[model samples]
Target chain A: MMKATVYVTIKQGVLDPQGVAVQGALHSMGFEEVSSLRIGKYMELQLDTNDRAEAEQRVKAMCEKLLANTVVEDYRYELEG
Target chain B: MMKATVYVTIKQGVLDPQGVAVQGALHSMGFEEVSSLRIGKYMELQLDTNDRAEAEQRVKAMCEKLLANTVVEDYRYELEG
Candidate 1:
């Protein structure tokens, strides 16, 4: 079996209102040391195949096809057993 | 300055409808090899402090107070320059 851990993050220069809101909340809660904050999505996938090459290709395809928005977000994945 | 990358994930046995929906979509899109799937949140935090220990404690406090719901989610963090 193979597992793919994917992280999908907004590209730089994109406006992240969610992050801003969280940061504001943190500041209100007294965490003034938090200078910046950004949020993203993380996914874990399990595949029935063990072929590293095939897993890589498939995981990449998955990211492009459904896991990420190529225009606004960047995705990277790590595959392991 | 210190950067903390935090990963927040649902605890095992929790009802993850979001993950299920995504898995279903993947299966329908012909990714039948996908045997399991889970989704979570990733956050990048920039701290203005140079103290690693202080940053670690503050980040942990942030996670507990605002970033994660301890009753249902598990969190881990890594700190770097």
Candidate 2:
């Protein structure tokens, strides 16, 4: 089996309200040293195939078509077997 | 300045509804090669201080106190300056 780890994050210049809220909550909890925070998504997938190239291609297609909003978010993935 | 990347994932045995929904969507989209999928949270933090040890300590505390729900999620972080 092949395993893929994908990260999906908002593009720069995007306003992340959830991140802002979490930062505020942290500060309120007295974690004053936190300067900035951004929150994103992490996904793990297990694929049946062992072909690295095929896995990579399929994973990329998955990210583009369903896992990420390419216009507002950027995604990168790592694969391992 | 320092940057920290934190990954928060649902603990084993925990049911992840969002992950299930995404997996279902992927299968519907014909990515049937995907055997399993899990989703979690990714966070980036920029801190004002550069001390590696202090940063690690603070980040750990932040994760335990705010960034993750220890009851259902486990968090790990990497730091860079």
Q: Give candidate 1's error at residue B7 in angstroms.
A: 0.2
User: How high is the CA lDDT of each candidate model?
Assistant: 0.94, 0.94
DockQ in order: 0.94, 0.92
Cα TM-score per model: 0.99, 0.98
Off by over 4 Å in 1: none
Best by TM-score: 1
Model 2 spans > 4 angstroms off: none
User: Chain B TM-score of all predictions, in order?
Assistant: 0.98, 0.97
lDDT of 2 by residue, B1-81 (tens): 999999999999999999999999999999998988999999999888978998899899999988899999999999998
Classified by CAPRI criteria, candidate 2 counts as: high
